[model samples]
Target: MILLFGLFFILLIIGTSIANSMFISSIIYMIYYGLPLEMIPQRMAAGVDSFTLLAVIFFVLAGALMNRGGITTRIFTLAEKCVGHYTGGLAHANVLASIIFAGMSGSAIADTGGLGAIELKAMKDGGYDEDFSLAITGASSLIGPVIPPSVPLVLFGVTASQSVGDLFNAGIIPGILLGIIMMVVNYFICRKRNYGVSPKASLKEVLKCFIWAFWAIFLVVIIRGGIAFGVFTPTEAAVIAVAYAIILGLIYKAVKIKELPSVIKETLGTSVSVLYILSAATLFSWILTYEQIPQTIAGYLIGLTDNALLLLLIIMLILLFVGLFMDITPAIVILTPILLPAVSAVGIDLIWFGVIMILCLLVGLITPPVGMVLFVLSGISDVPIAKISRAIAPYLVASIGVILLIIFYVYLMTLNPSLPKLY
Candidate 1:
């Protein structure tokens, strides 16, 4: 196991693709142990053969659907309506808009692209700096995976055999907390720069936008509320969300028949990337299991530390650093299996730990080296990565503050404790 892990890192350092890195590392272990190659296909298939994992494709498509269905614009309108009166009104609206968005789609990249494209442009048009627009939009996108129906959380739940509904419920409070902190930080900064909404919309106009878009808003409630009351599983909720978005899109005349092909193509491409990594990672984990590597490491770690909190924190730090180098979805798929048993050994709550892990890694995806969100903002704003990363400083501080709250404050971290727990 140590030899395999060492080789994986070496492959990574040399710029190998993570999928191929894991694949080669597993092959080294199999060869070392004189195992048959047949286990590879079998284990890989087992990993990919998950019903819960199918949620990844569904939610990814559902998020893209809502965006095309004119729901993105409606969400922006609603956020703008409610927060456009603040000192840093547009910035505040960006934060709030992301919170609303995180509910509809549990993907960080999707939210970043969907909401950031719209809000960053609006911010620039409203007298905000391009870099500043880039920064806030990127940071706001982090909330998506921490909120309900988060794709990473769903993946974690499925991979770890934790409760998906409980995981969804557990995410709500922390998600809102993440939103609030960003809004507060944005408010103070925007006030300092004196960048509020330019020519704020009339209440009538904002209300009109909201009224015209009311059904789009309802999808969040219907999906979340239905899931909470046990009316549908998360997978079923995904189907409902797609149907809802399509029906509403048609009713609003926002989605035309012509858009279907492009939408399907995009969704299929995205889903394939995710599913490919999943299948490959599963094969890798099967190798680990066959070798009893995870169990052996779990035992070794337990022997070293009994403090669940310390162990969990250390794991988070590792995730934070790893996230700096990789994208979130692949990281979650690859690492969750390896880490779950070890954390469980220390008695850390799986669901809570999962949220913490996702948050840390998601932030990493926005950090330097390979910060995916940073790159997204760079592409959108045409700001250099170095410059956009500078803009990330304050929000990064605020994110760390949120991370600390989740780590130390038990009641607040868990949020009402009565919210069905996920671990």
Candidate 2:
């Protein structure tokens, strides 16, 4: 097991995709264990044959559809109305719009790419620092997971066998906390730099734009609420979201029939990559379990520290380091199962762990070398990573603060004293 683990890391470091890396690693392990090659295809196929995982594809499609629908403008317009009077108004607007849309998209890259252009251009026109604008936008996009319909949390629940609805609800307070942290920090920066502040609009003006976006955001509320209340399953909610987004798009003329091909094509492209990685990771995890790898590692860690919080903190640091080079989706898919039982063995709540896992993965979207959100924002704002990295210092601090909160406090808020009997 140790030898196989070492080889996996080597393949990963050599710039292999997680799927290819996992496939190779699995093959190596089978040979090492004297297993037949025939099981490889079978295990990989079975790993991906999950009904819950269908939510992954649906969420991706919903995000693409929402992006194409006229909802993007309504969201931005609503954000502009609410925050355009603040110093660094456009920057705030971008972040605000992302929080709203994150509930819909569940992807930081989608938030940055879809909503970033307007914010970047507005901040530049308003004379804010380019690096500052991009860095803030990039960091703010992390709110996606914490907000709602979080892809990472969905993937985490499926991988770890936690309740998806509980994980979604558990994210609400922490997500709001993250957004508030960003807003306060951003406010300080704006005042310090003397950034532009738009003139205050009338109540009527604010309400007008919000009314325009009311239907758009209402869709998010209905989908999330319906799922939580058991009015619909996650799969059913996704179908509704797609239909709603399409209707709004056609009504507002934001999307047309000719554009359906492009939207579906993009959705299919991304879904395939994500699902394939999931399948590969599943087979890889099966091998790890077969060798009792997590059990062995967990035993050593328990010996090192019986204190649950300490173990969780240590694991978090390792995850932070992992985030530097790996993307969130694959990282969570790979690590959640390995670490979950260890944490739960110490009485950690699965829902809270899901939050921590998602938060840790969210950081990967902004960290170096593989910071997907950072790169997207930089391209839109035309800022260098070095400068963006420099500007992101405060947000890095904020994200860490959110992580620690979940580690120590969110468990109390999200978990019941006794889990309800499943039988």
Q: lDDT tens digits, residues 1-423, model 2?
A: 776778888998988876788878888888988988888888778767777777777777878887778677789878877898987677678778888997887777777777777677777787888888888888888887777788787888888888888888888777878888888889899999998787788999998887888989998898788987799977677678778888888888989989988998998999889888887887888887887878877888788887777888888898999899888877887788788768877877778788887887778778788888878776765668878988998998899998997787644432455643221
TM-score of 2: 0.94
RMSD of each: 2.6, 2.7
Per-model TM values vs. the true structure: 0.92, 0.94
Off by over 4 Å in 1: 198-206, 410-423
lDDT of each: 0.81, 0.80
Candidate 1 lDDT over 118-175, as tens digits, reads 8977777788878888888899999998888789988888788888888888788888
The segments of candidate 2 whose C-alpha lies over 4 angstroms from its true place after superposition are 410-423
